[model samples]
Target: MSAETASTRLAEIHSRIARAAQIADRRPDDVTLIAVSKTHDAESIQPLIDAGQRVFGENRVQEAAAKWPALKAATPDIRLHLVGQLQSNKAADAVALFDAIHSVDRLSLVAALAKAMAESGKRPDCFIQVNIGDEPQKGGVAVRELPALLAEARAAGLPIVGLMAVPPVGVDPAPYFALLAKLGREVGLTELSIGMSDDFEVAVTIGATHVRVGTALFGARA
Candidate 1:
């Protein structure tokens, strides 16, 4: 897409977000729009950045590691987030690149992240991913198990910052989002990563600090 076209599209997307936020009875600024630019080439995002987007989300560490360095080398201030399931084996690279990791679910990953932090002399903010839906295949801890996980993460000085979740495939997400907020507050977590293209408005209304928007902003992935 041409720069002009991308610029126009970005404007439209932002306007839609503003309208959605308004309709949801929230300030537009209260929701941070994280353009999920995974599977998208750097050229596709350059225009969005030109259109004033600074934060982007990537699902895998390798993909992000590849794209972020070049993007940062060019833009110098773009913030990258690892917003998908992260494995412990990739913890070191994740620690090196992402400004935040939004999917810290397992105790092993937490321990790996802490060790990586100690090794690198750097610590990135983390969110506890909760399996609010309780799906066996899901990549988060069960909701009832959150407090112990948070306690362990905190004890390790892991900079446990907030909570993140994906509601079950066929459930209303509002209650889950609210539950995350309540649990987050109980643990002094100030950040909540929820919502996507379809339900971001509900997320904003329920106090989501970050919404991972992929197709809504960038169009569907091939």
Candidate 2:
């Protein structure tokens, strides 16, 4: 996409976000838009960066490692987030690369992150992803197991920031987003990392502090 197109798309999404925030009586700035640049290469991503998007999300550490170092070196304020399921063995790399991790869902990964943080002295904020829809293939801690996961994350000294969830596809997502928000509050987590391109406005109404928007901002991926 061209810089002008990217800028227009970014502005449109921001306008929608502002409208959503207003409807919910929340400040638009409270919601961070994480432009998920997972499969898109550097050439495709730089246009968005040029459009003044400072925060980006990637699904894999390897993909991020390949593209971000050069980008970050040029624009020092850029923040990268790991918004995909992470393996325990990649904890060190994730800690070193991402400013926030939004898919921490298991004890083993928690332990790995803790050790990596200790060794590297880098602690990225963490979000406990809950399988709110209880989907078998998704990478989130089941709803019943959330409290224990939160406790373990805290005990491990991980900076547990909030909860993240992806509602079941082809279903109304409002309930799942509301559930994730409720769960976040119950656990004393104020940050709700819910919503995406299609349903972020609804998520804002339900108190999402972070929206992972990919397609809307970057256009449909190839």
Candidate 3:
């Protein structure tokens, strides 16, 4: 997309976010918009960056490692987030590359991340992923196991900012978003990494601190 198109698309999403925040009586600035750039190459992403999008999300550490170093070197203030299911082996690289990680789902990964952070001294914010719908294929700590995992994550010195979740596909996501919010409060967390291109408005009203929007900003991915 051209810079003008990117700017217009970004403005529309921001307007939607502001409207949603207003309904919830919350400040729109509190909601970070992570333009998910997964699978999009640097050439495709630069237009959005030119349009003043400073925060972007990517799914794989290798993809981010390939593209973002050059991007960030040019635009030092750009923030990159890893919004994908991460492997324990990639913890160190993820720690080195991402400003935040939104998929802390298991004890082993938590351990890996803690060790990586301690070794590297880069404490990127972490959001514990909750399998809100109990989907067998999803990568989130089960609801019943959340407290223990969260407590362990704290003990391991991971900077636990909040919780993240994706409701089952094709379902009303309000209840799931609200449940994630309640769970976060119960754990004394304030940040939430819920919502995406589809339901971010509802997620905002339900108290999402970060929204990962892709297609809305970049157009349908090829």
Candidate 4:
């Protein structure tokens, strides 16, 4: 996409977000828009960056490490987030590369992240991913196990900031979204990493502090 195309896409999504936030009686600025650049390379992502997008999400630690260093060096404030399942093996690399991590789902990952943080002295914000719909294929911890994971994460100094979830597809996501919000509140977490290109507006209305938007911003993947 051209710079203009990227800027236009950003504006359209922001407008939708602002409208949704207004309906929720919340400020649009409160909801951080993370342009998910999972498969897109620097050349493809540069237009969005040139259009003033500072925050992006990537799926893999290695891909982000390869793509973001130069981009971040040029724009010191660009924040990268890990929005995909995190492997314990990549904990150290993820800690060093991402400004925030949204896939912290298990005790092992929490321990890995804590050890990485201690070794590198870098504490990236973390959101516990909840398998809110009880989907066995998803990357989050089951809802019944959230408390244990939260306790362990907090105990390990993992900067447990909020909850992240991807509701089951092809369903009325409002209930799932509301449930995620309630779960976050129950755990005393104020932030929420819910929503994506399709259901993000519904998510914003339900109090999503962060929305990971890819197709809406970068167009469909090949």
Number of the predicted model whose lDDT against the real structure is largest:
3
Clash totals, every prediction: 0, 0, 0, 0
Residue 219 miss distance in model 3 (angstroms): 0.7
Off by over 4 Å in 1: 23-25
lDDT minimum window of 10 residues, candidate 1: 8-17
Model 4 / residue 85 / CA error / Å: 0.4
RMSD of model 2, in Å? Answer: 0.6
Per-model lDDT: 0.86, 0.95, 0.96, 0.95
Please tell me which model should have the higher TM-score, number 1 or number 3: 3
TM per candidate comes to 0.93, 0.99, 0.99, 0.99
1 versus 4: better TM-score goes to = 4
User: What's model 4's lDDT at 52?
Assistant: 89
Candidate 4 residue pairs that clash: none
Candidate 1 C-alpha lDDT tens digits along 1-222 = 578876776677667667778876777887778889999988888888887889899999998887779888888788888899998999999999988899988889989999999999878788899998789998998888898988889898898778999887667899989988898888788889999888887788788888898887787789
Candidate 2 lDDT over 106-166, as tens digits, reads 9999999999999999989999999999999999999999999999999999999999999
Q: After superposition, how far is residue 136 of candidate 4 from its true place, in Å?
A: 0.8
lDDT-sorted candidate list, best first: 3, 2, 4, 1
